[model samples]
Target: MEKEKVVLAYSGGLDTSVILKWLENTYQYEVIAVCINVGQEEDFDAIQQKALSTGAIKSYVLDVTEEFITDYIYPTLKAGAVYEDDYLLGTSFARPLMAKKLVEIAENEGAVAIAHGATGKGNDQVRFEASVKALNPYIKLIAPWRIWDLKSREDCIEYALKNDIPIPVTKKDIYSRDNNIWHISHEGGNLEDPWNQHDDSIYKLSVSPENAPDTPAYVEIQFETGIPVAVDGVKYSPIELLTVLNEVAGAHGVGIIDIVENRLVGMKSRGVYETPGGTLLFEAHKTLEKLTLDRATMSFKKSVSEKYAQLVYDGLWFTPLKEALDQFVDSTQQCVTGAVKLKLFKGSCSAVASTSPYSLYSEDFATFGEDDVYNQQDAEGFINLFALPLTIRALMNHNKDQKNKTDKKVI
Candidate 1:
């Protein structure tokens, strides 16, 4: 008889590393560690080696950075979906792609179950499990955080030490972090307290705004159908373009947000996010849409954006509603093609100018100077019709008042 195999979503982090060993010990399953890379800055080779050394029967490190950008980030970007008006949905969207790959590996290897280190308290556990169920309804999910006696990071650290497992964090300098190309999110530690101002030492991809340069830097971005294609008139691949923007905007200390957001698990979690490139792209894209998108479309899309963000954040990516919403978003983005000039200074990114061939803003019609397009006299009829309901209500009130006065006088 052979031992049942379980595919583990390995990250070389404290939780997953511990989970890798715990799964083998508890379930007596042959563990297969699958590390899915989504543009996080980590040495995959070392992670694979670590997984193999720590009782994994086999280890796989798959690079899905390009696929992540093309499939997850771009669609979310085009939809203008920002979770809770601050988070760029970096960690949210990446989870599904990673889960998809996990399922694929599990299916290929004929694994009996999939395991993840996501805790019960956070949104990630929901994200990972929801995605797994959506992709493969029958696959068993092994979540140690929900069942195991290890209640806190401290307990997990103690377990790792006893197990002789190499862990990353100490008790003193522990901040729960999720990193990808679009953004890096920091939570836990001092950020757990809402009143504590996060120290400047936490920033990884950018400088603190206080230490940013005095001079503002201007950047030009070109978009086609709502997708960023170039920066400063230089064409680049999606990954290359984002890398370039991240470097430029990061230098100016752009895209740092601190918020106490309500989680799907019915708790509030404080997080600090750094998203320099994503911030620049979003600002530029919005400016272009203002020039190209009509008033009604823009207004309706705002509502759709909120719902879309909620769906993504809640790990409902594979649902029909999200798919339909994507279609609606794609239709609106057809005309969102243009170039925008943005100014970055001290963690602020602002769009200064934009131009589009399909722009609805016509200078000839909007000019203050006298022109053939001017029709000042036409405003009277338009205003009368627009305010007809209000005018009628006022007249009705006046007639009621007059009749009441007459009745009083007659009496």
Candidate 2:
């Protein structure tokens, strides 16, 4: 009898590499490893070779960078979703796309199931499983982290050593990390302690603020429908735009954050993230929205943005509520077409200037100097009506006090 085939979301990392071997050894399943490249700086040829050498029957490396930017990154960008006002949802956004690709490979190869190395305690498990369920409901999921007895990274390394499985990580350098075009996040090891500051060497995408140039750098970003299209007046594709911005902004030490966040699985985890290009893009997009979006729309969108961020962070990306919220977010972006100039200094990005053709700001109505459109006396009527309820309440209180005083005298 032939063994059942399983497509595994392989990243060439310690956990995934171990899981790949374990699946083959234990279940007698032919594992097909699929690696999805979403702009992470990696050698695909080496990764593919490693997968095959580690016992995968076949291996694939799919370049999903363009699709990731256009489909996943842009939609989240338009929604202005930032998890906990700090994380850009980089890992959260990438998981769904990765799972989608895994499903595709499983269908192509007639695989009976798909597998991932996502831990049972983290959000990636939810993201991967939700996406797989949404895309291919019939495909069974094998989550090794939840089922395997290898409880810690130490155990994983020991298992790998025993199996002669080559992994990029060791017990000493056991910081579990996820990297992509948007950002890079570091967790595990010393990061597990909230009191310990993140080591400066852990950051790959951004420079330390202390080591940044004393002088500031100014850059302009142009957007159409909340998507960043240009940097410093040079138009580029979504990926190119991010690439250029990352180079410019990373040099100046623009984006770095350390936070202790609430995991979706009812635990707290400390992580450090570097999101250089994304930080600049988000700041510029917000400035443009300030110019183009009306006051009421902006106010309401603020509330909507919080929920959107939560949904994305919580691994609810494929749900109906997220889709419905995207529709509302898209409607708001129609007028969010503009340019914003920003000054990057140290670790901060400040909006220096912004303008939009659809801007509701009127120079004539807002001018400090005299204008024919304004009548100073007209404010009296407007004020009276606006204060009617307050005035009536005050009068009622005064009358009650007078009646009480008179009744006291009579008594």
Candidate 3:
């Protein structure tokens, strides 16, 4: 009989490397490692070799950068989904796409089971499993953190050393990190203590605000239907645009966020995120929307954005509700074409100026000097009609209060 085949979502990182080896030795199963690249810095050939050397039957590396941006990142960006009004859903949104690829590879390899490195406590576990369940429910899912006796990262490290597994993290400098083109997140070190400030040495994406350049940098972003198409009049591919923006913004120390967020697993976890390019893009997009979108649409979209952010954070990306929300978001983006100039200073990305062909703002009507539209005399009747219900309610309440006082005096 052929050995039971399992496909592992390998990251070429410490946790996944150990999981890849452990699955093979523990269960006597054939493991095929699949590493999907989403623009994180890595040696792809080396990752493949590492997995194969660690007793994997085979390994595959897929470049999903374009698809990741167009399918997942852009839609989420258009929806303006920011979890807890801070996180840009960096890791939260990345998991579903990763899991989708895992399911696809498992089907291709004729694998009976799929394994992941996400721990039981983190949101990635839910995101990965939920995505698999939505895509292919028949495949058996193996989560080592839930079943294995490895209590912590330290325990995993010891196990790796015992089995001669080469891992990256060391005891002295141990920080759980996840990086991609869009953002880099740091956790599980000094971040565990909310009181401790983020160390300058740990930040790889951006400089510290204090050490940033004195002069501000400015860039003009061009958007079409809410998607950023150019920067400073230069048309760039999705990857190139983000890459250039990351360089420009990171140098200025923009997009650094440290927060203690409520995890999906009913616990709070502290995390530090650096999303330089994404921050600049979001700021530009938001500024353009303010100029183009109507007051009612903007107000309604705010509520939708909150719900969308929570759903994405909670790993409900593949569900129907998210799809429906995406349709509404797409509709709203129709008029969000514009150009926005942003001034990037130390730790800040502020909109300098914005202009949209579909802009609803009327300078003539808004001017203090003179306006052809919007009659000033119409305000009196409009105010009275709008306030009628409030006026009536107050008068009736006063009359009732007077009656109550007279009744008390009589008694």
Candidate 4:
């Protein structure tokens, strides 16, 4: 009899490394580690080496950074989806692409299951499994944290030590993190305490706002159909655009957020995220939309954006609602082409100026000076009709009060 082969999502991190060994040792399954690069910093060759050394029968490292931005990141950006009004949905969107790749690999290798090292308590477990299930209903999921004896990161570290496996973090310097092209998230350690003012050491992508250069930096971004195409007057590929913006914005401490968000798994978790380029892109996209999108359309899109964010956050990216919302968002983006100038200074990005061919703003019509087309009296009829319901309601109340007084006098 032969054991089944499993495709494991590997990162060369403590959790996945331990899980790779554990799957082989405990279940007798031939583990194949699949490392998909969505622009996180790591040597792919080293990750493959670690996977093979940790008892993986084979290791794969695929670079999917550009695909991640164009497919996952751009759609979310067009929808204007931001989880809880702050998180850039970097991890949220990344998981779906990773899961899609995992499914692809599993199908290719005829693997029995796809495994991940996401903890039972966190959102990643839901995100990974949800996306996997959505893409391939038949593929089984192997979540080690939910089933294994290793209950915590500390436990995993101890297990690694016992197994003589090389792990990245020790118990003293332990903080679970996820990184990608869009953003980097840090959880656990001092971040566990909500009141613990975020330590500067936890940040990797950005300097502290206080430590940022005293001088402000200005950046101009160009967009087409709500998608960022260039930064600082330079055209770039999707990867290059974000990469440049990340470096430029990070230096000025532009995008750092610390929040306690409600996880999909019914628990709250505190995380510190740095999303420099993403922040700049979002600001420019939104400001451009304001210049071009009609007032009614923008207002309705704001309401839809919340739901879109929730769907993405809850790992429902492959669902019908999200697809439909994407369609509507795409329709609205037709006019969202423009360039926006932003000032990045000490953790803030402010839209300084914007111009678009589709701009709805008409200075000629809005100007206070005497103009041929202007008729101030036109607003009187519009206001009267708009206030008609309120006026009728007040009159009705007045009549009711008069009737009550007459009845009282007769009594």
TM-score for each predicted model, relative to the true structure: 0.97, 0.96, 0.96, 0.97
For residues 1-411, what per-residue lDDT tens digits would candidate 3 score against the true structure? 789999999988778889988998888889999999998999999999999988789999999988888888999999998999999988888889999999998999899999999888899999999999999999999999899998877888898898888876445556788888899999987789999988988899999988999999999999999999999999999999999999999999999999999999999999999999999999999999999998999999999999999999999999999999999999999999989999998989999999998989888888898777889999999999999999999999999999999999999
Summarize candidate 1's per-residue lDDT along 131-166 as a digit string, tens digits. 899999889999998999998878988989999999
Comparing 1 with 2 on lDDT, the higher-scoring candidate is 1
Worst 10 residues of 1 by lDDT: 167-176
Separate clash counts for every candidate: 0, 0, 0, 0
Query: Could you tell me which 10 consecutive residues in candidate 2 have the lowest summed lDDT?
Result: 167-176
Task: Kindly report which residue stretches of model 1 are placed more than 4 angstroms away from their true locations once superposed.
Answer: 168-172
lDDT (tens digit, per residue) of candidate 4 on 1-411 = 987999999998887899998998888999999999999999899999999988998999999999999999999999999888988898999999999999998999889899998877888899999999999999999898888887776788899998989976444655778899999999988889999998898889999999999999999999988889888778999999999999999999989999999999898899999999999999988999888988899999998999999999999999999989999999999999989999988999999999999999999998888788878899999999999999999999999999999999999
Q: In terms of lDDT, which candidate is strongest?
A: 3
Give the C-alpha lDDT of model 3: 0.92
Model 4: lDDT of residue 127: 91
lDDT for position 322 in model 4 = 92
Flag clash pairs in model 2: none
Displacement of the residue 262 alpha carbon in candidate 1, Å? 0.6
**Local distance difference test scores for all models:** 0.92, 0.90, 0.92, 0.91
Q: Which stretches of candidate 4 lie over 4 Å from their true place?
A: 168-172
**Clash pairs, model 3 backbone:** none
Global CA lDDT computed for model 1: 0.92
Question: What's the lDDT for residue 326 in model 1?
Answer: 96
Off by over 4 Å in 2: 167-171
